[model samples]
Target: MTWMVTGGAGYIGSHVVRAFGQVGIPAVVLDDLSSGHREFVPEEVPFVQGSILDTDLVTAALREHGVTGVVHLAGFKYAGVSVQRPLHTYEQNVTGTAHLLEAMQSAGVTRMVFSSSAAVYGTPDVDLVTEDTATAPESPYGESKLIGEWLLRDQARATELHHTSLRYFNVVGSGTPELADTSPHNLFPLVLDALAEGRTPRINGDDYATPDGTCVRDYVHVADLATSHVAAARALSEGRELQRVYNLGSGDGVSVREIMTAMAQGTGIAFEPEVAPRRPGDPDRIVASGEAAARDLDWVMRHTLTEMVTSAWQARQAR
Candidate 1:
């Protein structure tokens, strides 16, 4: 059966698309290539150059592919940047979601795995977050994603659709060499770029209450994340009771200093970072418990933090 992968040309989206292809599940990619690179998509995947907000284009693609399901991944995802452009964020994340759902229903696609985020939990009072955690998203980006979940629920109530919104935290690492994040947002790749240019990677804050006095967050490999997408798709295809939401994470927190040290060890480079003021809306800690996903989807993340960082560095060196 063919599936439609919105944003199938971006870093995480491209990985998910490749996973589907590797499993012999045919996929059609709809990407505007705004932030997504054309080179990231696999050559054999059918590519549609368009936006999800384009209702007619999306509907046509869905019908053309005979889409059995969708894995929604397209959105503007920079938390800090969302604060600068809240309206743009909402239009892309929320309005675009509504457009996609309408198109999906029109095309007879009934299942999807949404790429939600742990950011929806905002700064949870507890250090570790679960699916049941209260959501009080501080940034428009997080709020938009939470609203997307609401949109999903609303659609399910009115249609035959079932969805699994996977709330993940700090997606990192690289599996395919060609699919590495060439963008400059993520921590690991940004640091690698700085060190490669003989500049120091900046540390945002050093006085947090964590073990190393830096903000802590969970990091999961992109490959493991892609694996969960396949699992979610299979579960829905089998007509199993769909899990409305699941957290995909390592359930362990890694600190900024710890990550820097890991990078130093992995790349054989030692340099002090320039300590700077914390970026606005930066959470002190965020670690998600993936127990529910493991129980329901039988998912396991085999990549270690060191391995994730080293693999990213390898991809960086290749670039």
Candidate 2:
């Protein structure tokens, strides 16, 4: 059965698409190209150039492709930018999800895998965040993603829908050199971009409560994340019951300073990162336990932190 991957032309989306193909599943790409590159999508795979906000186009694509399920990843993903542009974030993530669900119902597509975010946990007051962590998102982007999950939950109760939402932390690295994270807001690109340009990479702040006095976050490789997405899709397609939500994390916390250190080793660029004032809404630390995901979704951290940086650097250099 064919599956439609919304935002499949973007970084993480493109990796998920390739993972599905490797598993012998046919996938079609539907991306607006807002933050996605046209070349990121494989030429062999079918591509629909449109937004999930366009219900009619999505419905037509689903019906035409005979798509039996959907991997929903399209949304406004920048947490910091969402603070200043909440309305735009809502329209893109919340409204876009509703519209996608509407189209799925119209086309009788009953299976879905939603790409959620760790931001939904806000500042988790725990050593390790879990699926049961109380959701109290701080930014509009996080709020929008939580709303997206709710929309799917609400819709599933009323219709023939089998769905799962994956709430993951910072996603970095690349599955292939051809598919790089092009998000200007993402950390891997920002640090690598600065280094490539002979500019000093800047760490947001160095006054946090972490051991290194910088924010500690969970960063997972993109390829591992993509494999898990496909696993979730397969579970849904096979009529296996999955948790409503899962946390795909490393169960480890890494500070910004540590990331910078890894950046230097990975790129062979020896320079101290400049420290800047902490951005608003940044938490001191947030890591997650992937126990549940590991048991169910075949989740595993196959790539080390150094591998993450080096792979990301390789992709950046390829671009």
Candidate 3:
């Protein structure tokens, strides 16, 4: 079955597209290239350069590609920036998702795997967030994702759409040296970029109650994340039952200090990180249990922290 991968030219989307190719699944790419690089898309895949906001363009792409399923990944993704650009975030994520769903309906495409975020949970008080965790999104980016899920649910109730949203946190690492995380806001990229520029990476805060006094978060490799997306899409295509959402997370988390040590070891940049004040609203820790996803979506953290840093650093240097 052929699938349409929105934002397929992006770092994470490109990895997902590559995973699909490796598994012998036919796929086409639809991306506006606002944040994605055209070069990230493979030469052999059909590429449609357009925004998901355009229902006509989306519908046409789905029809033209004979897309049986869609993996929605295109959206305004920066949580910190989303706070400053709430309207832009909603327009791109919430409205864009609605338009894509509408286009899917028009094109008779009924299966989808939405690339959601753990930001939907905000700063959960729970030690290990489960699928049943309350969704109290703090940023517009998170809120938009939650709304997108709601739109999919409502549409599913009214139509033949079968879908699942994968909520994940701090995705890192590279599946291939050619495909790397380029997000400026992500921890790995930020640190790697700083080191490449001969600047010391700074820790946001080191006064939290955690072991190292820095924040703790679940970090998953991008390739493992991509495989789970493929599994989710395949499940939907094969009429397998799936929950409305699943958390792609590591039950045990690594602290920001641990990441800093790993980065220094992986990059051989033995400089001490500058300690800075905590960014407002920063939680002490946020980790989720991937039990649901592991059971249904083939979720797994296949890369160690050192491997994540090394692969990411190597990719950044290559770029």
lDDT string for model 3 (1-319, tens) is: 8999999999899999999999999999999999999999999999999999999999998998899999999999999999999999999999999999999999999999999999999999999999999999999999999999999999999999999999999889998898878887988998898999999999999999899999999999999999999999999999999999999999999999999999989999898999999999999999999999999988888898888889998899899
Give candidate 3's whole-model lDDT. Answer: 0.94
Off by over 4 Å in 2: none
How would the candidate models be sorted by lDDT, starting from the highest?
A: 3, 2, 1
Candidate 2 residue-wise lDDT at 223: 99
* Sequence-dependent TM-score of model 3: 0.99
TM-score, per-candidate, Cα-based: 0.98, 0.99, 0.99
Clashing pairs in 1: none
Candidate 3: where is the Cα deviation over 4 Å? none
Clashing pairs in 2: none
Per-model CA lDDT versus the true structure: 0.89, 0.94, 0.94
Ranking by TM-score: 3, 2, 1
User: Candidate 1 on 1-319: residue-level lDDT in tens?
Assistant: 8888889999999988988888899988999999998888888889999999999999999998788999999999888889899999999999999999999999999998898998898889996788889999989999999999999999999999989899987888899666677766889888999999999999998988788889999988998899888889888988988679999978888999989988898888998888999877677788989999998876688898889888888878887
Q: What lDDT does model 2 reach?
A: 0.94
Question: Alpha carbon lDDT of residue 118, candidate 3?
Answer: 97
